[model samples]
Target: MSSLPPVTWLQAFEAAARTLSFTRAGEELAVSQSAISQRIRLLEDRLGQALFIRHPRSLSLTEAGQAWLPSIQEAFERLAQGTAEVFGPEPDAPVLIRATPAVQQYWLAPRLCALHRAHPELALRVVTGVWTQDFVGEDVDIEIRYGQGEWPEMVRESLGEERMTPLCTPAMAERLTTPAELAGTTLLHAAGFAVGWPAWLAAAGVEEIERDTHRLWCDTQVMTLRLAAHGCGVALAHRRLMGSAETLVAPFDIECHTAEGFWLTRPARRSLREPARRVWEWLADQTGEQWP
Candidate 1:
């Protein structure tokens, strides 16, 4: 393991050393003066060196402290530069948007091409998965989620209702002639939507359908669609996500209601930055007719 002091400690020490006052350092770092002293003490113990010579009325740097100050300040400067480059507002750079695999592949990818064509200066980086909420903690500016628009401490805007239907490959479609045939076929399910299969079956006028009968279960909509396209089994999928080749045939005429819908979420405090707002508007425009 690395023996270096924690980055937090190093930062605190550098700030305190530069200003030569714990109170001033705390003011710069937005912490209490006592917290600054504590951090410096921790850093000194970890490094096994004294960084400051405490006096009655003033603080002075020891020889070791003076030698370390320049390096520490430079290190922090580099870190700040790197962080700004990665997350800073650069209008020409690609904006990072987080979503699940299904939405990225089916909904966003196609529309993004149009966005790029219109604003070639703007690029897109799509991050996918259930853990994507962590992206907000990173450089990501916006996130598209399939939920009920109830995310805490975030600005949630309803994108639209993603209506789902029973879809299958051409081969699976040939085998399933009626809604009753679904019981015998391999029913593929996605983990994200808890009520996909049940809600779809209810809409199809079928009751008592066996949930345990599902042969394939995937966490991502992309995986479910891939399995469905490859004739793994009949899958209940979002109609908007289905491509011409993927949706070779419709298994059932009846469409179902999903408990979850697409929503645009961002940090409640941060103003919708330009790139993020542009993408949001584009998505809203694309789904305007279908959203209710």
Candidate 2:
């Protein structure tokens, strides 16, 4: 285990280094000025490095302090990003549909307009992310999860089989005619997808191509699909997600099926509320797919 200074000490040092004033750092952090000084002292003692140069009336960052500030600031940024991804946005309805960010932004968000038009009396909320929500106790009534149709204690219904195909804008589609031709152009992949470029290429019987040729990888389907729609490159995306975007086009007829799928699920013990059941049935109708 590494023996770095505590987070509070690091925070105190970062704030003091930025402002060059302990009093100002304490004011910003809502703490006593003496407390800030004490923390900094403890940190410097631990590291055995003089971070700040103390003068009679003025203060300035030493060589060591200037170098450490950027790393500390970057750590805080990553922490905030992780927090947002885990907790996600707040729900505004008693009946909430929880799913991944890609589905929420591209597929479900557009369908919500039709849902409202069909039944304005029903109010609904959606929570989006790549992480799974706590359906056992949370207020989420319906969850569209991406995986095998098994959730231990939850009731699972088949939304659809997950199919992946290469998609691009109409302008970009004009240049491609066959699966082999794709190697000449930029290939995009969603890093989080169950099936990616490797599986799609293998299914298409494409072999012995350069892997480094202008390729882009995205962490989410929303970004990957949007990049394809904007003509950035050809992205491999789910059939349903690709259908949602009007600007995207599937130039080839080849597609690959993955092991995972979108499953409409809820706790077996807690049946969906009345309003949630209405939306759930409407989703089944909108997709023209059967559900159990």
Candidate 3:
């Protein structure tokens, strides 16, 4: 107590040191990036040493910081081990999860609320991703990815069926009552799938639809579907991604199914804690399949 800095200072240091950036450490700690920076500064002042050299674009640990990091890491690891050994596991700790925005907003939100109602103690920290790199960094416990599930070192299970069809606003659906009517309406296209309006149109016998017709191309599925929802255009989206019970009208009986769809993946070697397992199994259960 005589000379030791506060415990938060050491924690901020450890996280910043491990991440090599205060911003990332703040994200991991669920605090502001500035807070992480401030605590480290206070620690530096208390210890009479500069822990990090702050550059315009990066951070580097000073000699004193490098010398102190090992002890800090060991101490935290020991605390975790001791806590697990004596007090058992902290199952309520937020489960870090990364999901495609489509899944997070439309497919999983209500179900998650249901899950929470059932197990009020279980916690989840859901983040959304649209690109391959959006799911990178931060050791997320579970990922809802949109792909064919070929990621190496990940145990994958497909979610829901692979069915897709054209959806639009109710007003638009009323007007474009038939598949042929889509020729005049804007076709919202989201990239990722090999198939799109071309395949769906062919399948629905929607030929004669002009190539010169208006179309909106987007990089993410969520955005394409969003524009369609707001009456901008028709989105060819997976049936499972349409957010709720009554929203996003399917204007046609014709729909297509492919082998590609959302897949839930986690590291093959990592084990889910009790709470995280509950959320994982709950998601798998939503699709009516058991996750390996």
Candidate 4:
């Protein structure tokens, strides 16, 4: 006949064996010392073996108990690890997000303040770059990309679309009365989107202008807009990100849709984690508003 009391009895035995003191084990398990001793006694009786040698001042493990202790400890440890992986404080490791500087500074950064207010425990790491790279073996958990939603082994969701319009300082706006007048002024180019200048020019019906004539170049859209705000030149910027910057003003009554948009990408397998899922949902909600 089999002789095992129950899983709880095994837990009590393991705790008692490791501490070698019923009182301490009881405190660890949130039970009384007498209760702990009783469970151990019951388990020993069922197994027909003395697990511990009780003494007036101390306790010692019997030969049978010594052999069983290691297995009991390993079993408990495995169970604990499994439980934590399934439902516990999700690995306090920082979650990394990859994005361009423009989106980070103008769009994601402001909304993250609200996220911080709501979820104080979540840690965010932002990585800015011009092109997408292999996320495998990288620290990135999520990526906010500007392109068509087409990634090989990752899940993709469109966050928002971008509309390009000519922006300059108020003084520059007054001088540049027509699109053709922009030929003499500096034109800013943001990295990774070379078509912005031509698209704007075509929309404004100005074919005589030369895009390659611009001498100034910036790596990010945010930097280009900043340069324009300081009257350095004119920049084609996304309207959604221009929320309330008073220094930059759009003129010429011309706007065109860019071939690219914002996308949230992550490994399909890693997306199953709770923290990643939560961040994805938050991003989708933030960009759900209709653009003005």
Error of 1 at 103 (Å): 0.9
C-alpha lDDT score of every prediction, in listed order? 0.75, 0.77, 0.80, 0.77
Top of the candidates by TM-score:
1
In the range 1-292, model 1's lDDT, one tens digit per residue, is 2777788798888888888999999999899999999998988887788899999878989999999899988988777666654545455656778887666766677788889899887667887757444444555667887777777867777766667887788777787888877886788888757567877777777756655365688877667777777878877777665553345567677877666788877766556568778887887777654321
Model 4 Cα lDDT, one tens digit per residue, 179-261? 99888788888877846787888888885686545657877788888898888899888877656456878867778887678
Q: Which candidate, 2 or 4, would have the higher TM-score against the true structure?
A: 4
Q: Per-residue lDDT for 1-292 in model 2, tens only?
A: 2687899998899889889999999998899999999999999899888999999987898998899889999998777655433442233345678888876776577677878997888887787657554343455677878888768877777777778888999988898887888876788877756678888888889854537447887777778878887888998888777656789989888899998887777766555557777888877665554221
> What clash count goes with each model?
0, 0, 0, 0
Model 2 residue 283 lDDT score = 77
If both were scored by TM-score, which would come out higher, candidate 1 or candidate 2?
1
Error of 1 at 183 (Å): 2.3
Each candidate structure's TM-score, on Cα atoms with residue i matched to residue i, is 0.67, 0.62, 0.66, 0.65
Pairwise lDDT winner, candidates 2 and 3: 3
**In angstroms, how far off is 226's CA in candidate 3?**
2.6
Error of 4 at 196 (Å): 1.8
Report clash pairs, candidate 4: none
Worst 10 residues of 4 by lDDT: 82-91
Considering lDDT, which of the candidate structures 3 and 4 is the better prediction for this target?
A: 3
Cα lDDT, model 4, residue 82 = 54
CA lDDT for candidate 3: 0.80
Off by over 4 Å in 2: 1-93, 132-137, 210-212, 287-292
